[model samples]
Target: MQDQTFPWLTTLIVVPLVGAAVLWALPSALRRFARPVAVAFSLVVLALAAVATSTFDVSTAGTHQLREQTEWIPAIGASYALGVDGVGLALVLLSVVLVPLVLLAAWREHPDAPATGRAAVLGGDRIRHYMALVLVLEACMVAIFAARDVFLFYVVFEAMLIPVYFMVGAFGGLRRRYAAVKFLLFSLAGGLVMLAGVIALYLNGPGGPQGFLVENLIGTQMSTTTERLIFLAFFLAFAIKAPMWPVHTWLPDTAEQAPAGTSVLLVGVLDKVGTFGMLTLCLPLFPEASRWAAPVIIVLALISIIYGALLAIGQTDLMRLIAYTSVSHFGFIVLGIFAFTSVSIQGASFYMVNHGLSTGALFLLAGFLVARRGSQRIADFGGLQKVVPVLAGTFLVAGLSALSLPGLSTFVSEFLVLVGTFGANRPAAVVAALGVVLAALYVLLTYQRVFTGPVRDGLATTPDLSLREKVVVAPLLGLMLALGFYPAPALDLLREPAEQAMELVGVQDVEPAYTSTSTIDDGSDQ
Candidate 1:
């Protein structure tokens, strides 16, 4: 670990937290300025994140950098510890970049007028509360990614649920409460199982003032059964958060019912926590169990690939379709992680960031369309290309990126994953590759239904993307194009961490079966 005297990580977490509190405590007279105030705070946080990223040393991407630690719970051996490697830094950057955009996209999301009926019964300024919850969520996202202590990570992990719960339940659509409850139930169940694993693993470690630090626990001696059991406990929690096929039911409901900006963060940044944990903590903490469980996990991932894509093809609700697509994308991430090849893990890490940009744009664009027509159903839209060309065009680019078009960012990551996985497990790679075809079906078919053909009766007069909306989307699309063309910079950051993961798992890249050589003969010799 490379420790920094300045508390960069803590400041990143605290700024948004203090912003949230300030938003909540604003005077009634100044309540009208809530959205601007919130946006300003988010922008400041983004600038700070940029500075932090600039300070990160890409040369030492394998080990944690800018680490900060202090003793917290001496009896239980927990400490306030934080740091970021290439992977963590990538995610932290993703979270900060998206927050200001999400805030801008949702600027007019909540009305300033007093609430009515149920909302009135729970009186307060809706915009203020919603923006504040988003900030709080931002703080938690940063903390979770940077946390280096097991206890600190787990605490922030569970604490994330509170803000998301209110964001959905209070600020979402008609079925908000039901969706929020379901999300909470699934997450809590996973967290509880993880808590058990955390306790068991700690008890097995060298108990001391800082026993729960990840570095200290990495190579602890344990029996085979105990380690495998603990690994399962942690894996199960991640899978649910990863929201793999069987346990993935909650995501579509939540995505469909929650506000679009909320959905962006929920699916975009928060879900990455699961796959991130598997890569950073699981493999290092329990290497044997990871190898033992690889085959089963790979099978589940393949299932998610096919199952999610197929369901996405059959979806009517636009939000649900996008949600299912994420399920498929996440399957690829999980597969790359378990493939245990340097290239595949690098792809998985890159996939996390790319997925955020592409899918976040999709969700936000879909939200904009839904807001215009007052519907999320594909059947409710048509001929929108003529009516709203800019919106339709942007949506097409984002959708194409989702399908992993050759010139887009997702293609690079998905390609690396398949190539790497093929070397380790040919059949799994073959099965997962079918998802690409299925992806085209879902993306193009949905585009045709929603943005092509004759203008639907009510949508002919639909407006195009507003200036603010364009501002929200332009950077996301720009980044995708930039990364797609030149991925070397991002790949450089990802390579060492991927290699470290492979090292921990005691695996190496698969070597070629044969080498070919050719010699040129000169005409004079002939």
Candidate 2:
């Protein structure tokens, strides 16, 4: 929303990268300050994000704002372009907000280790490598969301895997290498597929530099078959990232192996790329294909919703459970987008933001529990509420939010998604609604096993949330509550984008088949 004249988006992207470079270059003796430095840089970015949002002109909501551009790769029609629409801005802001918190949560991960995988990877300079990667990850995520050029987005999209790969492979649990490779392979396979689409778009595009800019690509003429093929390529990549069913195999393994902070970013923010791509690229670029594919996509979304929830309910590992829930949540997002109505698209957009906050909190808090207990198994501890009330309480709130409790932030978006889906596809909506019930079962069932039952031995010794940990989680929890109660501002920002999206696809809300008075008069006549 801020003026493009200010260059805030570039600053937001560049600062973290600069911080990462600084952290990497620091002398070994000073590496201990890496966490603080990372946090400071991330906080500045967050502040800049806030400032950008403060200046955003919601009245011009549907189009990209705060545009910045320069020539790059003229041969390929790519540019050093950056901008944000409401949806993209929300995702960028979410990344900035979560990075600082993730750094804080991971603060002690390097320090307390004497001889661990993390210690081995960075040797004595554990903090530097860890925090530097976090900042780099933040930079890439911002670039992905802010990119106005399709080629640039693809570059950043694949580039994002680098930091995450190291974070998980070098710094994670025993099977970290395996999980990291699985993640990379899955992502690369998708990326390669999407690259085909990108190349196709470029070849078929309008002449000159304007071809790759999103603004130019919209509504470009293409044959039905070519559009469908490109749509499939792009959708495959996004679906793998979204981890929608069949293609979702890598997520649970990675979540179970990666550190809590890494898992948080992977699921909370990066995965949003899939649904975001669907809304931003797939529908607009290939409107007819999207409509043609809607029925199949909606069915897949419905399957993910129910299947993910079921798997979560059956999980014994806490992290795996959380990972499965995301599959379910992402289903809601995809369903909303393909439902082809204003309310559904807006709900999907808002859901992206809310899910990031709520799920990020859940992962961080769960990390704390794992750190204290030295285990990731859900059955490893019980009746924690009596021992660590604050920690247990925080977990409860986050879990409830995950299940879409009535007043939680997730609830608002989830409700909108279902309502919107019902309008577009009643059968899919009906099946997807069952996911809510399954969600409750998983959240409550996990709680009952880990927090509510009789206190197990050694549980009493588990410490309550320290002030630093509480400070780390407070903002996320507060945000969940705030958005839950007052979602109007978010809805306002999302409304125009949703309207524009609807316009792009030539969709409008369908009036109800029968009005109340008309139904009554027909009944009386009968």
Candidate 3:
């Protein structure tokens, strides 16, 4: 339990939301200050998140901490409840860490720069609106991560699509509208399906305040048919959000068209809700159904790994290529979760953070390239390292992390995932391992094509990373290194949730077999 003296979790959600409102309501005369104000608010939330993390009792991390609740509507068995286990805290931290950076990176997303050839100028209110939406999106992200009530989670889950939809549609590139509509349609379809499951869970549950609380729903009684039906409802939604293979079409489009900051939040943090849902809701809520669905899910996960990697390798559009890489990375996350081992689950959880940083940097750096070159096509520029060694170097490091380079943040999580998968399903693990090769091929190939050849006809004047841009990307790159060399802090935070999740699914690691072979000389036993 958290100290009653302060509602830290609620504050984390409210601060950004309040800032959004203030920014939105500011008079036009004073509106020029909106961006800085929004950034300041995000920094405050980051500070609060840091404080909350520092005070967390890792010894009790397996269970929810910093719990805060208030009755929203007792009649429907819904309440405004929030809490964080190690997994949720880790994700919340990811959100906070990324939001301020995103704001800084996107400081000019609204007003199109001449070189980028992005959307035309907007009214004076555009920056205000954009910054407000970003803050709102951040608030929803925090709420979803912390919500302990299934009903509340669903509300925030569906609500999240709103700000992102606008961000894509209003502030993106040429095809922003199409991409935004596609993203919204897919997400809404999934949300509606998941809502059905939430309703069913409520109807079949023990009536009263405890009904929607996750703590009360686990191990609850339901007919096998009911359980499976509800599981499918939830799984379909999460799978779509996870944007697992078949349902992943919306992502590349959105990534290509949306502003880079929007893409960062969408792929880096928002998409994580899908895998997070599966871990926090699906398995625990329907243990039997999860195990029953494991084989099929694992197969799909494998397909996502291979299929996404292949597509990424083939892509000409840089943003779309990065999008496909996330599809592949997400496959690993889902594979780790459904593998039902402590190591795998923890790896998946840790991967969420690592993926956000690694992939986020990739997108940001790629966006920088696009902004400078005014083209996303791979063939448009070459020999970039000679002109912008710092930017190219940062991109290379980020790319290596994506490929799970040793001593990088992603390597720790990826290794754990593969090892855990091997323990559970050798064949699946083997197939998924192929993704590493594909990852290397795509990343290296992209690097070679874009940075190795002769400089394009007129790109010599392209500048290296500016002070602000470097500042924006430095922490993300630095953390990847910091975490890579020393993941003990993160692993310690993740262990408890992994154990708890394993307990829910009744899974334990399979011990390795050691055969004792004795050489019997003349039938003598030694």
Candidate 4:
């Protein structure tokens, strides 16, 4: 790990936090400036992230860089540790990039309006609260990905629930309260379990001023039973955060009820924490346990892939449909991580970034559609292409990307995942491949139902995307296209970390069965 004199990670975490506080503390007279102020803050954080990315040493990205450490809780040996490997950097970049876009998209969200009864009793400036929550969430998201201490990671991981809870409950749709409470309950349960694991891990480590630092914890000895138990503790938290099967029910409801921009962050950057934890913390800290658990995790991943797609196919709510697709996409990510090949791990890391772009675009565009129509139901509108060609076209592209259409960024990552998984476990890969087919069904069928029939009664007069909306979507699509054709930049950042993960997990890529022969010289030799 390369320690830095300058604390880049702290600045990245603090700027948004300050921004959120500024929005919250803004006087009523200046409340009108909340949106621009929030946007400005997010942009600043984005600039800092760009500089950090430029300074990152890609060659040694397998090791942490720009690390900063100082003692925090001496009693328990915890410290304020922060760092990023290639995988962590990729996720950090994803978090910062998405926040600005989400802010811009949500500019007019939560407008002030007269309320009755309970809403009146709870009333304040809704837009201000919403923007503040987003910035706060952004800060937490960055901190979680950059955290190098297990205790710090856990704190930020659970702290994130605060902003998200309000974003959904206070500013979301009809079922906002229900969705937010459910999300909180599920996440808190997972966190409590992981908390037990974190305490157990520190006790198992060499006690010091910084005992909870991930670097310090790596390779500490433990019995099979102890390690496996700890691994399951961490795994359960990540799986629920991952929203993997059995624990995934919160996602669709939350997505359906939350504001569109909030959903983008929730599924796009936030959910990645689970998979990120699995790769960076789980496998490295407990290799034997990861290997021991691989078979069951792989099976669950396959089920997530197939089951999520099948459910997505039957969804009537646009937001809920997008949420289910994420469940299916995350399955591919998990499969890649546990497949234990360098290629597969790299693919999983790449998928995390690409999934954010594709799904973020889908959610934002769906939000635009809902804003125009004032409804989230797919059956509420039809024949929109002619009336809103630009919106229709963009939605199609985003949907196609979700389905892993060739020449799209998602296809490259998903292709790598399947190919790599095939080398390790062919049957699992084969079953997961069925998700690709099901993805096409859900995406195209949704498109057909929402955009392709004769002009629906009210949609013919619908306006095309406004300039602000277009600006919101253009960057995400551009990046998707750029990465789709040329993934080397992302792959370069991901490769070393992936290889390092394989090393830490004590595994190697499966060898190819066929080899080319270069010496066929019967007649030529004669």
Q: Candidate 3: TM-score?
A: 0.96
437: Cα error in model 1, Å: 0.7
Least lDDT summed over 10 consecutive residues: which range in candidate 1?
A: 114-123
Write one digit per residue (lDDT tens) for candidate 1, span 363-471.
9999888777777778989999999999999999999999999989999999999988987888999999999999999999999999889999988888899999999
How many backbone clashes can be found in candidate 4?
0
Residue 332 in model 1: shift from native, Å?
A: 0.2
Residue pairs clashing in model 3 are none
Clashes of each: 0, 2, 0, 0
After superposition of all CA atoms, the RMSD between model 2 and the true structure is 2.4
Question: Per-residue lDDT of 390-465 in model 3, one digit per residue for the tens?
Answer: 9999999999999999999999999999888888788988999999999999999999989987888878988999
**TM-score for model 4?**
0.95
Instruction: Give the residue spans of candidate 4 off by over 4 A.
Output: 110-124, 513-526
lDDT by candidate, in order shown: 0.91, 0.89, 0.90, 0.91
What lDDT tens digits, residue by residue, belong to model 4 across residues 262-321?
Answer: 999999999999999999999999999999999999999999999999999999889999
Cα shift from native, residue 196, model 2 (Å): 0.9
User: Where in model 3 is the C-alpha error above 4 Å?
Assistant: 1-3, 110-112, 115-124, 513-526
lDDT of 2 at 424: 67
Q: Which regions of candidate 2 are displaced past 4 Å?
A: 1-3, 110-124, 512-526
Instruction: Estimate TM-scores for all models.
Output: 0.95, 0.96, 0.96, 0.95
